[model samples]
Target: MKREHIETMISQEVERIISGTDLELVDVEYVREKNWYLRVFIDKEGGVDLEDCQAVSEKLSKVLDEKDPIQENYLLEVSSPGLDRILKKDKDFVRYAGRTVDIHFFQPYNGKKDLVADLVGKGEDGKLTVRVDGNEEILDMKTISQVRLHIDF
Candidate 1:
């Protein structure tokens, strides 16, 4: 199976596995960095703990093993997305609305391609409504490179 298809299949299986639970599947990625790796990122109301990771990891590992989808040996890792979680899905944008985020753009907008701003949810036109310097700014979603939750310490 192709990488994208494999990832999609894994995501579907994970959604089923974590259905009816507080655990929300954040993202699933299969990458090669020295070795093949299948990472499952999950989150919940109070954040995920090691126990949560273990449970998901064990369940997913068993299912994948039984299904025998991948031809290569890969490490299966299940964990939280962490404080600086990247927003990839719509639920993330909605869930993290009003939170501060670090945005990186593919091209500079207003002479800036990187900055911290408050996420105001995605607009209907696929643009992002953000509050920067107490003013609202609409960013073209296509120009965005990455949006991650900003951590203030």
Candidate 2:
């Protein structure tokens, strides 16, 4: 009924439809511009192609149509998270260990607004140790307001 609940439902349905496939749902959003848009971002080990998007879109459309969770007119879109995917959960940090990431803390740490570094490891306490500019810093997980993979240009 609520936006988050709807998103979670859609995410679960998408995950189920793509279970055997390489794709995984990254995020889901229900937004309004002219009409409501239910956007679903998906990713894979390599990447997602248009064909993959089409397949997921078709299947999800059927389920949504049957469930009728959204009362208003909406467009469903399935696509990739692109080069820099945000890391929202602890699993993301563990899965992307050793990759370069940019994390923003809720409060400044050592007078820094952002930290760009290699994800060294996660401590037993759930804090993250990142190597930034050859120095290691322990970032408390509770303080991590946002995190994303750093795409090299």
Candidate 2 residue spans exceeding 4 A from truth:
32-35
Query: Over the stretch 71-147, how does candidate 1's per-residue lDDT look in tens digits?
Result: 99999989999999999888789999999999999999779989899999997788998999999999888999999
Q: TM-score: which candidate is best?
A: 1
Candidate 1, position 139, lDDT: 87
What are the C-alpha RMSDs, in order, of all predicted structures?
Answer: 1.3, 2.0
User: Candidate 1 — which residues are off by over 4 angstroms?
Assistant: none
**TM-scores for candidates 1 onward, in order:** 0.93, 0.86
After aligning candidate 2 to the native by TM-score, how far in Å is the CA of 76 from where it should be? 1.8
lDDT of each: 0.93, 0.88
Clashes of 1: 0
